[model samples]
Every structure is written in structure tokens, then in C-alpha cells.
Target: MLIVHVAVTVLLGIGAFFLLVGSIGLLRFPDFYTRLHATGKCDTLGGGLIILGAMIYHLFQYPETLLVSAKLAFLIFFVFIANPTATHAIMKAAYKTGVKPWRLGEERR
Candidate 1:
């Protein structure tokens, strides 16, 4: 269906856009913490939306593969939970290890 295709396209596009934003932030941000923050938020949502698009597409295009969609849903959930948790853990580790945040006029690490 045209509508279904459009919806899938939109989700995929938004997901890709977020992914791009995350990558740019990773490259452009001044410091490690900020980069981590960028990727953590954008990547989780981007990856989740991409997977959601896949799940939706499969649900409509292959009705018998409900199991596939269910599995993808689990994957989406895992990414949503795991990425942020992992990011926080890493940030905590960085803080504990005395990895300093960037201040103004400092050279990039």
C-alpha cells in the first residue's frame, strides 16, 4: 500500500537523520563526554526507529512473520535500554577515572 510505504519511508528517513546527527556530533563535539551524550541520545532513538520501520514493514508485507516483528520489537527495546545504560556506565567510569570535561579555550583531546 502507498500509505504503508510512505510511513515506512518516513520512519526510516528520520532514523537515518538521527544517526547522521549522532555521527556528526561525535566528530564535531569538543570533548568525550559531549560526544557520548550526543551518540547516546541520537543513536538510541535512530536505531530504534529504523528497527521499528522494519518491524512495521514486515508486519504488513508478511503477515505470517509476526514472530519476526516480535523479535525486532525485542531488539528495539534492548537498544533503547542498553545504549543509554551503557553510555551512563561509561560516563561514570570516565568521571571516576578523572577524565576531565572540556572547558572553554582548551585544546581538543
Candidate 2:
């Protein structure tokens, strides 16, 4: 039980850290595509970790809530699928519209 608690804490902390990194990347990256790449990957992992942590905690605290746990599991699966798909769709649209990639030495405001 103690070990499980510790693991949940660690997972939640790591998840928060990754989420912070994703947000930073989203804000600091020079271009839309780069930002999307950073947030798409990092945010996915971050969210997964956080959800995993929550599920673990819930599992320990309320083992009877099988329905809730299953819902969380489904949420995890949905996020894993949807985030990257959405990113890809946005990138595809941007490319089709001829949005130029950012180049070195280009001034962007």
C-alpha cells in the first residue's frame, strides 16, 4: 500500500512536469508546426501519466468503482488517439493552405 502511494505521487509529479514542458514548448517554439510537435507529443505523455496516476489512486481508494475506473481507462485511450490525430489534421490543413515553415534567420513577430 505504501509503495503504491509513493508510485502514484511520483507519477503525478512527473506528469505535471511533462505538462509544464509541453506548455513551455508550445509558447516558446518559433513556429506553429514546431509548437504543435512539442505539445502533441509531450502533452500526450503528460496526460497519460496523470491519468494513470489518478486511476491508480482511485483503484486503491475505491476498488469497487469498476465503472469509474473503466471510464478513466477509456479516457486514456481516447486522449492517446485523439490528440495526435487532431494535430495531424491541423498540420495537413496548414500544409494544404501553403503555410510556410519557419526558416532560420527569419524574423517572426
Worst 10 residues of 2 by lDDT: 100-109
lDDT of 1 by residue, 8-93 (tens): 99999999999999999999999999999899999999999999999999999999879999999999999988998999999999
| Candidate lDDT (C-alpha), each | 0.96, 0.93
**Candidate 2: misplaced stretches above 4 Å?**
none
lDDT of 2 by residue, 1-109 (tens): 9999999999999999999999999889899888898999999999999999999989999998888889999999999999999999999999999989998888652
Q: Could you tell me the TM-score of candidate 1?
A: 0.96
Q: Tell me the TM-score of each prediction against the true structure.
A: 0.96, 0.94
lDDT over C-alpha atoms for residue 74 of model 1 = 100
In Å, residue 10's CA in model 2 sits off its true spot by: 0.7
Instruction: Tell how far residue 14 is off in model 1, in angstroms.
Output: 0.5
Residue 77's lDDT within candidate 2 is 98
lDDT for model 1, please: 0.96
Point out where model 1 deviates above 4 Å.
Answer: none
Cα error, candidate 2, residue 101 (Å): 0.2
